[model samples]
Target: MEHAELDALLTPEAMTLLDGLDPVQTTNDVARVVTRLRAAGHGPELVSAVVGQSRLRHRAAAKFGEFAGRMLFTRAGLEQATRMSVSAHHAGRFARAGLRRVADLGCGIGGDSLALAALGLDVLAVDADEVTAALAAYNLRPFGDAVEVRHGIAETTALDGVDAVWLDPARRTTGHSETRRVRADDYSPSLDWAFELASRIPAGIKLGPAHDRDALPEGSEAQWISVDGSTVELVVWTGTLARDGVGRAALVIRGGSAHELTAPADTPDEPVRELGAFLHEPEGSIIRARLIGDVARSLGAGPVAEQIAYLTGDADARSPFATTFRVRETLPADPKPLARALRERGIGTLEIKKRGVDIDPAEFRKKLKLSGTEKATLFVTRIGARRTAILADRLE
Candidate 1:
């Protein structure tokens, strides 16, 4: 958002108009709403700001829930903001460790700060971007003195009076739209500076799930978190914020329930064995944390191939760490023959899952002429040295 648009958005008139309008859920409604507001004599800035905010509020509902209706956001800020569920978990870590005051550096749209303040922790939320900082202040206004939003560079932000710190560095390009991921060294606070600060203070640094594990600092606990099967972020904790003796962890959250598996460090890969009756695919967070071996040991399973993440075991122990599939048949490796076998089995609706292969599921699905009432998941992966396809039923 431009500085002028933001100024107009903060006015009492804009806030009232935004509050008065219903949530904008469709792109088709935007033009009508924009025209109506303009016809009502609202200036372009007010109309654009109100309409834009209405759209963002609806989009943010997935992350902030009902609280999104009362919050303000910048496109980039909302996109980079941590999910409320995850942020609540992050806040709980600090609270559990006896932390009372926290400096949330690079606090985009005050998402983490909101969770921290709600947990009764005094929060100082800092963002370098002017518009983002303003939006954060407006969003966090309900917390009163419990939260403070500041406009400053995270690398130089003051840590006075704060017992702990949370850093979510800006890892993308600058613009609100058309932003792309930059290297870890290009992070706003720079990983080097962030690591230096972490070593000196109790701190938690949030990074992408795919962040270079080799870049991790020694003695830090790296936790990978996934929400609803999607691996979201990796958090590195240092000093008192770090859980004792825990070097690696995977936290899987699905349908509001959270399950965690922790290890002292990266464990060796489970021994490769023949594919068992049941094939288990580890959750993305577990794969990212490199703790699949721990999960395999727990389930009495082993990898299907050397270094392959797919686990195989006949055990019926349902685990939250992985999705289990009951193997029905192993189809031919070639796509044409596999498609034929699937058609013969009366499989119409199919979920194509692949690893260790270079085929697009959407494109491959189009090639199959399926017509039947049965539905099954197709796994295109490698077993030993040969590529294979497994038709399996998803197990709960």
Candidate 2:
């Protein structure tokens, strides 16, 4: 949003209009609201700002829940903000360590700062963008004197009184909306400066889940977190916030429950073995943390093929770290033979999963020419040196 539009949106009249309007969710909703507001004699700027904000609030609900109704957001800021559930976990680290004051550097829309303040910890939330800083102040207004929102550069901000720091350096180009990803070398405040700050004080640095592991600093705990089935972010913990002797961690959150697997360092991969009755696909967080070995040991499983993430075992086991599938049968790997085999089994709806294979699932699905009532999953993968197809059923 432009500064003028933001100024228009912040007025008492605009805020009340936004609050009174029903939730705007679709293009139809936007069009209807725009027409009604324009007909009511509201100026174009106020109408556009309110309509745009309403649309953003609908999208932000996935990350902020019900709190999104009152909060404001820019497109890029909302996209980069951490989910409320994940932010609470980040806040828990500081609260558990007995840290009372935290400086949340690059506090986009105050997602993490809100979580920290909600736990009764004082917060100094700083964002380099003026509009983002204003939105942060508004979102964190409920915390009253406990939270202070500042418009300033994170590297130059004074941290004299804070007990710890939470750094989420800008990984995208500068903008209030429509920003593109920037290279790691171009990160705002610079990783070098951020890492140096972490070394002297308890800190948590949030980065993309796929960040290069080799580039991470030594003697710190790297934790990859996945919400539902999607791996979200990697957090590097230093000083007191870093758990003793733990170098890698995977945290998986599915629905209301959460599970964590931790090891002193990257666990070695298990030796490859023949396919067992059940196949296990490790969660993204586990794969990213390189802690699949620990989960495999717990489930009495081994890799299906060398360097493959899929695990196989005969044991009846269920784990939060991996999804288990019961093997039904092995089929011919060739597309023509596989289609014939699937047709003979009366399989109609097929869930195609592939690894170490070049075929696109959608195109391959069309080639099957399927026509039946039964449903099954087809795993197109390599077994040792040969390509193979495995028919399986997901074990809930």
Q: Over the stretch 226-340, how does candidate 2's per-residue lDDT look in tens digits?
A: 9988999999999999999899999999888899999999999887878999999999999999998888998899999977889999997989999999999999878898999
Pairs clashing within candidate 2: none
For model 1, where is the 10-residue window of minimal lDDT?
175-184
* Model 2 per-residue lDDT at 294: 85
By TM-score, the best candidate is 1
Q: Candidate 1: global Cα-lDDT? A: 0.91
RMSD of model 1, in Å? 1.1
- What stretches of model 1 exceed 4 Å from their correct place? none
**What does candidate 1's lDDT look like per residue over 306-335, in tens digits?**
868899888875689999999888889686
**Which residue pairs show backbone clashes in model 1?**
none
Question: Ten consecutive residues with minimal summed lDDT in candidate 2?
Answer: 174-183
C-alpha TM-score for every candidate: 0.98, 0.96
| Candidate 2 Cα RMSD after full superposition onto the native fold (Å) | 1.5
- The positional error of residue 83 in candidate 2, measured at the CA in angstroms, is 0.8
